[model samples]
Target: MEPSVYREKWSALKNAPGNEDALSQLARQIAFSFVDRYYQDGLYRAEYIDLLCEMATSFSDTQFNNKASSALFEIIVEELCDDYEEMPVEIYSRVMSQVISYCRDVPEGVALDRRLTDFGISTFDDLYNRANLVHSRRYTYGAGRPPEKIILLSRVTIGADVAILSVMIQRFMKMFPDAEIVIIGNAKLEGIFGGNPRIQMRRLSYARGGGLFERFSSWHAALDILQTEMPPETEQNVLLVDPDSRISQLGVLPFTHSDNYLFFNSRKCDESAKHSCMAELANSWMHDVFGAGDFCHPTIWVPSGVRLRARRITESLRAAGCRRIIAVNFGFGTNPRKRLSDDFEIELLREILKDPRTVVLLDRGFGRNELLRSASLIADIGNRGFHASVACFEDSQYPRTSHGIIGIECAIGEVAALIAECDEFIGYDSACQHIAAAAQTPTLTIFAGSNNMDFIRRWSACGDTQCKIVHVNTLADPGHVDTDEVIARIMEERSGKAPGAVEPAHKIPEIKPPRRTGKQAKKAVDS
Candidate 1:
């Protein structure tokens, strides 16, 4: 063998047979030499590149001092280049990419693992981080393919922030009607539209798993699915709504592309307590990912228009005596641990029947208590007592009803239907809020928190004139206040008691900024 070949083989097996110390030392020396030599010439022969990659991978398998491991990893990555001759372009590119991933992650794991051992906290995040390190190792360093279509990704079903999702969807429809809107969830909340022509849905299987690794695997797998299944001619404007605080901190929001990348953050206002910290972390993340040339974006506050539409439809339907409407909720379907029992909803049946204007609409899948409670709240103050037209709205199968108080299964346009039929909205802080708002109907939104109210406020086309937000003091002390309070507020605002008090005049309606006309998309990415 030639001198270099022998040396490569020796370094590759340096950590063999319990000689970890020698192995680590040899790896460090080789790493330093490669980085130093490349810094001088700004290039590497194909043979040297291959050897360096192999050495780094071998070093990655070793358990060494965390700092030393980190330093070695950095050196290996700093020396990486795409130029090579011996291997096919494809294989060379793949190997080089994998090597760079190891350089970025393995050393970080080595350090994090050691640090965690000192403090002793065994949590899901630790496991997730470890898996992330391994996952990063699998990544091959190469340029990403240009996106076919830039999508605005929202995980509306994962949490209860329906109000924000509804407004965002409406704004997206208004701003980019030509662009395809794909929601990253399987919830049937869109069923309200009687089948929306513009929106598409994709499911990420994060909800099925039991373990931390499974969820991470699901998330990573979803990313792969997204990349692989994307069409050849898709738009290149992807935006992910990352509301989670911790993950946003890790810089997941500032996604990269072949041409351009942009980070969106809202400054700390009164909207979300978590907003300031999340923005701070996102700022750091932007710096790490994009080197910080203004990571913040202008944000606008708005109301949930979907709820307004739904409430309006509910009112119209009641006027028509459409008493068989089911409140099927495919979204938020069955979380026994978190949701109230159906039997509890059934108890409100008495209050609903008192008005003698509506009847209970029942279905097998619909939870009775939940629907009844919703019915009671909506029916409580109407001139005539009210009842649910349908028991369930969330369903894969279509219902026969021409009119009813549909729940979570429906979509934006359905609010128009509800507005045309129903008397008032009995909507929660879900996407229906925006739909109701868009329909310009009386809506009462039961809010859990004030986060994302900015976007929520814009969906209400009446500029907060048609809707009222009701929030309890605490989650534990949950109790319904009289809807009259909200009704009074709505009426008072509509009467022009104080236009400034209801919605500030300075608050602009939230909408996505148009792409720059003159610049290439990559310029946007860079900025």
Candidate 2:
């Protein structure tokens, strides 16, 4: 009979036995029966270890707080070595507690056997399980044939990529209405995909042995979905749209036989000239994910200047009952552990806000408290005349956006809307600045007008070319200026009286003379 069944029968036998010795013998039989059934059947490895540890703990703590019981517990610990490498954290913690309890019971001179003393396998197992739990709860790239393929590309919290996620889901539904899209991410990523039947979601929790493997396992459901919808027999083409920047090399994917192509959905190569090395690598990864040998994939790159919906910022500001708004985008790239000083970007913002007539709306993710300090400095400057307010979304009443779903309370989409409503946008180079430009707001971008300025000028897509489109440098004399210079230029241009646009002293356009290919052309130039 099953050990559980035998144990139950023994429980009844204890009540019906003739004496205490008989009951004790039956109890021993029951314990051995459980070990035999569980171990031999390979049914409850975890349960067996837990039960043995509990028995050893109780025995050491009460009756056998001596050499014999201590030795027995050590034997039990050694026996568990094979499976300890993959044991769950909860189980490991329970077993470790029992081991520690048993160790405490041992007399001062009682030494653990050399074989039992070695904790390398057990400790590694425990740590591995713990790490797995952390990763299990995070975003995963799943495996095998899934019913559908839903890929999330994000460098930080997935919330910042909500615009892309939402668009992808909507597009996926349009392409495959009957199918379900599985979203695999952290606990904080739940509400973002809620109320969508086409979306089946799972949270990866490392706390529950949901580490990297578990994270990968969550994607198994996605693989199941992909397989169902896109079987091998059909030879369906799968395109990987990676916007978060890391692109695998051009080759066969590590797993699966599906003919798939990777697509990078970022504007990395839109500039007229080359970018920095890191920027180039980010673009390269996107292509590599698509199996493109070179970094640039002409056929696959998303045409530059794709339009996103004008998430009306001016309207949101008006609804919030604010007027004469100034959106300060003081976002800078910095590592969390690094201490921040007044960099070039911060210096420019301080000088720009010297005029009291401007209000400041700050993007909070720039550099932690560094951003707050920059805003505070700007606030100090603006206090003399105009009212200044920092834009934040911590209020529970504020509806959750993609960023809020990821616990990054402030939403870039909302900031974009505010910039649309504001009189001017000022900031260092960042995605927030790009979003503002997309919103058609006048923007003052603080880039030193050096060699890189040529690239910046070509890439900038802001509609209003007046006061907002000015660029500055770190070493510019008299710091930076804040005014409606762009507005002035636009008004003058409209009135057909702008000095910059005014015809030069010579009305005729400069034409290139013929190339000096021969002596005649050279002589004409010399004359």
Winning candidate number (TM-score): 1
Q: Write the per-residue lDDT of candidate 1 for residues 1-527, one digit (tens) a residue.
A: 23285376555565453565665555566556655554566454444444444443444333433323343334453122111112222222333333333333444335433433443424434433433332222222122542234343443332222333443444445444565656554444444322455556565544321211222234444454456544323324444443321122222212223223232322222322222222233333333332323333211112235434444444544556555332322112332322223332333333334334443332223357654555543354232333233323333343332332233323333433443233334334454444343333344454442233433342222212244554422235435534445444433432343222323324321222111122111111001
Residue 233 CA displacement from its true place in model 2, Å:
10
lDDT of each: 0.36, 0.36
What tens-digit string does per-residue lDDT give for candidate 2 at 1-527? 44455446544643454444444344344445434554576443343333333332333123322222233222332233212223322333344433433332444213222212332223434433433332223222234353345444332233233323443454445544554555444544343344344555454422112111222233344344445544666433333333432111101011134434233323233332133222233333432332223221010011111111112333344455544445665554431111113443344444444443333455555445756665565465455443334434444242211110011225444454445545556665554454444344444554433224434532343221232334443334334433344334323332342233233232221221111111111101000
Off by over 4 Å in 1: 1-148, 158-181, 187-196, 208-210, 229-263, 266-420, 427-435, 447-465, 474-527
Q: What TM-score quantifies how close candidate 1 is to the native fold?
A: 0.42
Q: Cα deviation of 345 in candidate 2 (Å)?
A: 6.0
